[model samples]
Target: MSQANPPGRPLLASALGGLGLLAGMVLIAEGGRRLPPDPPSIAPAQGADHLKAASHAPLHDARPGRSARKVAADLIAPPPLDPSGIERTEPRPPLGELGLAPRPKTPMPRDWRETLLFRPVATSSAVFEAMGRTVAISGTVDIDPDRTCTFDNTDWSCGQRARAAFNAWLRGRALKCFLPPDADRFAIAAPCALGKQDVGAWLVSNGWAMAAPTGIYGKAEMAARNARMGIFGPPQ
Candidate 1:
C-alpha cells in the first residue's frame, strides 16, 4: 500500500474544505443583506375602494374610456324641441314682464261705402251707423200706420208728425252709442240719448207717440191725450 497520506496533511485538507463551505455561506448571507428590499406589490383598488373612487369622481369621468369632449357633450342638456319639430313661440312669458296689456283697437275701413250699413229693424228699432249695432226706443209704442186719429171730423194717420221729426233728427248726427247690461249688440237700450234727449220719452210726452201697452209712459200719453195735442186734437 502506498504510504498513507501524511495524517497531518489529510486532516488539514479536511479542515480547509469545511472552512471554505462556511465562508461561502457567510458571503451569500451578506450579499442578500446588501440587496434593497423588494418594493411592496401594489394591488389594484377593489370593492369598497373602487366604489368610493367612483362616488368621488366627476360625473363625466364615471363612464369608461370616453374622451373629454364626448363626456362634455353627453353631460350637456339637449336643445328643447316640440314633438312636431316645428319652431314656435315660447309658452312661458319672460321673467321680466308678466302681465299683458290690452290689445290695440282694430282700424275701421277708409271708405264710407265700405263702412257698416244700418237699417230700420222695426217701427221703433233701427240698426245704427255701425255694423252689428242697433238702438231701441226703451219705453214707447211704435206709431201704427194703420191706426187713425179723429180731429175735426177728419182722420189723421197716427203720429205722422212724430215719425217725420224723428227721421229728420237722426239724419243730422254722427252716432256713437253704448250697450247696457244684459243688452245685445243690436238691442235698443232705454236710456238711449240723441243729443241729450231721450227720444222715446220726448216723442210720447209731446203727443207724437203712444205709451207702450206695458205702460212705461202711460201717464205722459194720457196727459197729451187729455190736452188734445197732436193726433189727439179734436176734429179740426
Candidate 2:
C-alpha cells in the first residue's frame, strides 16, 4: 500500500509548474520580436518604379551603394583636391627663345624688269658666278684636244693650256651679265680689260677656242687661224 502525499508538497509542485509555463511563454514572445522580419515582400522587378530603383541603387557600402573595395581604396588614397595641382620642374621657354621668332619681311620688286641680286655658289672658267647665278661665256665654245696647230706635230693638250690661260685672265676681274630670253642662258660680254690685258680678245686671238655658231667672235677666230697662233700654231 502507498502512503498519501503531504498537502504542502502538492501546492509547491503546482506553483512551480505555473512559473515554468509563464517563463516559456515570455521567451517565445521575445524570440519572435527579435527574429529578422520576413524578407521584404519582393514586388515583380518588371515594374517601371522597380527598374528605376534598381538603376539608381548604390553598388557599395558605407558610401551608399559604393562597393566595400572602392571605399577601402578611397580611405587608402584620397582623391586629389585639384587636378592641376602638380608642378612642372622644367618650364617651357618663351616662343622667341625657342626659335619660333617671326621672320623679317622682305621688300618685293616693283616690276618684273627690276633685278634682285643673290650670291652664286659655284664658278668655273666658262661660267661666271654672280648673285648665285651662272652666266656662260656667250660666244665661246669649250676648248678640246682636237683643236690643232700647223706649226708643230708634238701631241700637246691645247684644251688644258687654254683653260689655264682663261682662268688666269679671269682672276681679279668682274663682268656685267644679262639674262637672255631663254631661261636657261645668260649673255655677258667681258669688258675690254681683265687684269692687265684685254682677256676676251686675248682668248680668241690666242687660238684657244672657236667662235660660236652665233658668229659673235667670228672675226677674232679668223685672225687667229690665219696667224697660226695659240693652238693654231706649233705646240709649245
Candidate 3:
C-alpha cells in the first residue's frame, strides 16, 4: 500500500526551498560589493650604466698591446669608475723631536702609452724607453765587419747601382714613398770591389741627384736619398 504526504507538511517544505534559493542570491551580491579597486604597479629603478653597456655589443679587451692608443683614448673618455679604489699614500716629513720613518709615496700608474712601452707585462723581456710619440735608436754598427764588403761591380756598380736599382724597385710600388738604404749605413753585397766612386755613380744613374760628394764614405751615405722616397727626410 502507498502512503501520501500530509498536505500541511508538503506546503512547509516548498516554502523552505524558495527561502534557500533567495538567501544564496543575496550572499553572492553582498560578496561582489566588497571587492577592492585594482592596486598600482611599482617600477624598478635602472642605472645609466646598465643601458650603456647593453647598447654596445661585446669587444675584445686589447688593454695590453695597444697601451698608447688605449691611454690616449682613456684620457679623452674617462672610465665610469676607477677600477682600483685604493688611495695614494702621502709622504710624511721627519718628526721634530723623535725622528720617524717617512711614508713612501706610491707611484701612480702611467697612462696607456707609458704602460704599453714601460709596463709591458709580457713574456718577451723587451723594455723600451722613448720620449713623445717616436722611438729613438742610437748605437754604433760593429765597424769590424762593416769596413770591407766584397761585391761584383760591372758597368753598373752592383753595390752602389744596386742601391739605386733598389730605390727604383721600391718606386715601382703604389706606396706613397720608399727609401733605399744609404751605402754607408747599409752596404751592397756584391761579387766585385765597391768604392766611394761606385756608390756615387749608382746614385746618379738611378735618377738620384748627387749632393756635394764628401770624400768621407760616411758623409756620402748620409746624403743618400730617403729610403721611403719622400716619406721621411734623406737617410741619416
Please give, for residues 1-236, the per-residue lDDT of candidate 2 as tens digits: 99999979989999999999998899798875664569666567656787788899976556656555445776799676775887669867877635766545433333323222243321333444555445555566656534433454576766666666666765544543334334235444322334355435566777776777763567788999999877777675
Candidate 2 versus truth, CA RMSD in Å, comes to: 22.4
Model 2, runs deviating above 4 Å? 1-125, 128-131, 145-151, 180-200
For every model shown, what is its TM-score relative to the native structure?
0.38, 0.37, 0.14
Candidate order by TM-score, decreasing, is 1, 2, 3
Candidate lDDT values, in order: 0.58, 0.58, 0.34
- Write model 1 residue lDDT over 1-236, tens digit each, in one string: 67767769988999999999998899898874665689875457566786788899886665778655645664596867688888678688756524665445434333312111243223332223334555556567666545577776787665445555556666645443444443344455443455666666666777767787764578788989888875577432
Which digits, one per residue and each the tens of the lDDT, describe model 3 over residues 2-118? 998887998899999999999889879798565577985434455566567778966666677643335577679966877598588887777673585454543423421111222
Better of 2 and 3 by TM-score: 2
Which candidate, 1 or 3, would have the higher lDDT against the true structure?
A: 1
